[model samples]
Target: MFRNVEIALASLYVTTTGVLIAGIYYVHQILGVEQWGIIAFLSLIMTLVVGGILAKIAITPLREHFHHLERFSKETLHELNLPINTITANVQMLRKSHTDEKSLKRLERIEIAAEMLKERYNELDYMIKKQSEREKIEHFDLREVIEERLVFLRSLYPSVTWDVMIASYVVNCDRIGLGKVIDNLIENGVKYSPKNPIITITLQDNTVSIKDQGIGMDEITLMHIYDRYYQSDSTMAGYGIGLNLVKRYCDRYGIALHISSRINEGTCVKLEFKKKGIVDG
Candidate 1:
């Protein structure tokens, strides 16, 4: 889309250049006033014709490239679902069958890996489907969703202890989308924190905060944190798309998202929910 805009602007520049040249020639060389009007009209027509042709030539290839990329991404995401589901199901079955401690622990690791893969897949799916499908927005209890996600995540990150202080906050938005945002924030806190780290989660005044005493990022990292596929530390096991997706969801729902951090201190992510209404009446 940006490339197309550049092409259009270039075409306009070409038209202006042509018009300027013709106008200069008419003023300096041509003496007949009647011919001047005729020449100016002819120049305008010629400029439009040339500009239109050049814009078409410049934009067609770029449009085709983006279309091809979109198709490839959709096809790849479609192919991934079958294998991810298979791995997840098999891991669950194995966990149920294995009673031994070491075996169960190994199985748990596999389950966590499978779950992470599934989440990345879902994010990709959301990016593609959200453009076409109308969002299933409705009022849902924020506290309920937060607790539900914590239940699923707690076992996965056994070392990190969560401190949650939530009041009855109701939000009108897509529940699943909001859950993803919450999941990503908590996951990041756990992933970067030290052994048995404390994660503070608070929800009040229509705002949710996730704070971690982990390896906090620098200013440069914070600046590019929301960019797609931009990871601050390449050593960390993340594709760097999670926070970007969170930003998109927040923008769509009028949620104000903010992050504050300093190296070796900590990081705090605050999400202020926009009001549609309150539920705890």
Candidate 2:
């Protein structure tokens, strides 16, 4: 700390001395008392070069400081994932084995929240690490992937209705990442929605959207929907980082992401692709 202060003070002194010397030299030249400004120019330029180098050197530590903070968050979430997975699994087992209907229902809600938290942990890990930028540009069938997960998601809810428009659509993307985006969007719809709510998904051209008639979020939460590290206090447990990573992934691939919502009405997430992707007819 003291060292930085000393360096800063020295830089200030150098700046002041250079400015004073140049001003005096200019005055001397104007009064015909001096014929040489060569030394003054060189000194001024030297001061600039040295100050720039020193300032850059100071920024290195600040960069490392932020890196350390992100790494610490990753480590913390990694530890949290273990207990969360265990708790969710045990809740499932208990639901099947135990006969208490009310308790079992409560456990189911806890399990869902736990699983959501686990997914958020996964997102944090990917976002903090140096992820590959070339992963989402490959060509593949997106509708097939959606169909593959459809049965599982349907069984999990057994109430909310989903209307998928595309029977078989192909797109350019990293299958794993895009699959997660779809899963999270579906999960969000199911989590916040009332029982038997209607969830609609449409894929046309190069765009896909998941719209849910759930208790939608307000304007404030919608604005911070993609915040890196956020938490919601409305009986839902999430690290609030999933959509942020999805937005990041899409943006890197030149995809446009749009979200809209009205309180007590519904929320819509629209993803528009810009690559060699085709939607099912």
What TM-score against the true fold does each predicted structure earn?
Answer: 0.71, 0.60
Per-residue CA lDDT of model 1 for 1-281, tens digit only, reads 67776867786787668776876576547854566667677677767777777767777878787778879989999899899889988987887788899998888888888887887797777766676475677788899999988987886788887788988887888877788899999989888888898999998878899999999999999999999999988998979998999998888878889999999888999998776444221
Candidate 2 regions exceeding 4 Å error are 1-45, 92-107, 130-140, 144-159, 174-195, 213-249, 256-269, 278-281
Model 2 CA lDDT for position 237: 66
* Stretches of model 1 off by over 4 angstroms after superposition: 1-42, 95-97, 130-139, 174-177, 215-252, 260-265, 276-281
For model 2, the local distance difference test gives 0.73
Residue 40 lDDT, candidate 1, scale 0-100: 75
Highest TM-score, which number?
A: 1
Candidate 2 per-residue C-alpha lDDT over 1-281 given as tens digits, one digit per residue, 9 for 90 to 100: 44675676677667757765765665566555554575556556766776676666666666676778877886798799889979977887887778788887788678767766766676666555534233434577877777766755775777878888974556765676777788878888877788898989988777788999988988788878888876444568666777887887677566789899888798899888764574221
